[model samples]
Target: MSEFRLDERLERDSDFLTKIGLCELRLMKDGRWPWLVLVPQRPDVSEVFDLTPLDQTMLTFETVLVTEALKTVTGATKINTGALGNIVRQLHVHVVARSEGDANWPGPVWGHGTAEPRSTEDTKALAARILDALKP
Candidate 1:
């Protein structure tokens, strides 16, 4: 067994929000969209199928939980969920809130434009809102 560690690239691109069951829920720093990354706290796992059966179920449950919270907080028209590890080879799921007429409407958020990082105050406020929404 190995100790779990978040990939450096992910750590650089996102801010840690809170732990959600089997994963650490992080907020992407990009202000373009309300995005979250759920990284399973399991070492050496690069894909969802690599997780144990129980962990796989837990991951699915947490993903939905966070996604719902995001929708509630952002009032997004649609939610985009994905696990494309083409760049970062870590087992992480992305849950993004999308709305019509956004900067890149009817298209993917990735590679559309350079990411505009959120300010410190804005980030803190948004994180607080998300935390409040995640409460049971």
Candidate 2:
């Protein structure tokens, strides 16, 4: 089997945070929201069903883990998760924290506005908080 590699677009648009059982967790660079991306480590897979049964189970568990961690860290009113691979064909899941009056409140976060890139210091700080929340 080919070794796993992150898609170039994902690599460019996000910062690596940490890894879980079956995925590499990344923080999206857009500072508009507390967004996280979970990419399964399996190479060349582009859909959830493409993953093995074991991996599918692990993905579900990890997705929930990430969603809760995001909510804990951000205290968001609601959390959103999606796996629309229309643009990035990689099998990645998004776990986003949302509030009542965020920049694009009640609307989708994608394609609504320009991304405000997070500074390195800010990114590291957020990632550390998220990692801390993910601990058992």
Candidate 3:
């Protein structure tokens, strides 16, 4: 198999955070919500079923870990997880920390409002917090 390459769209939309198990962790550039994405480092795989059974299991574990970490870091009231590949065909899972009255609230975060890009410093700080949360 070829070396894994992150989709260009994902690369453009998020900042590299850290790697967790079999996935490449990413922080969505949108500041409106504490969102994290997990992209399995597998070439040409565009769906969860595209992964091997072992990889699928590992991805599930990593997704849960990230969901918990995001909730803890953001003190979110609710957590959202999905793998909607409509826009970005690359296989990735989104673990978003949601609050009661956040911009969209009770609704989906996508197509709701403009994404407020995080400043470099802010993004770094958030990434650090996420990394800390992921620590054992």
Tens-place lDDT per residue, model 1, 51-99, is 9999999999999889889999999999999999999999899999999
Question: Where in model 3 is the C-alpha error above 4 Å?
Answer: none
Error of 2 at 123 (Å): 1.3
C-alpha RMSD in Å of predicted model 1 compared with the true structure: 0.8
TM-score of 1: 0.97
Compared with the true structure, all predictions reach lDDT values of 0.93, 0.93, 0.92
TM-score each candidate: 0.97, 0.96, 0.95
lDDT, residue 134, model 2: 99
Ranking by lDDT: 2, 1, 3
Clashes of each: 0, 0, 0
What's model 2's overall lDDT?
0.93
Q: Which stretches of candidate 2 lie over 4 Å from their true place?
A: none
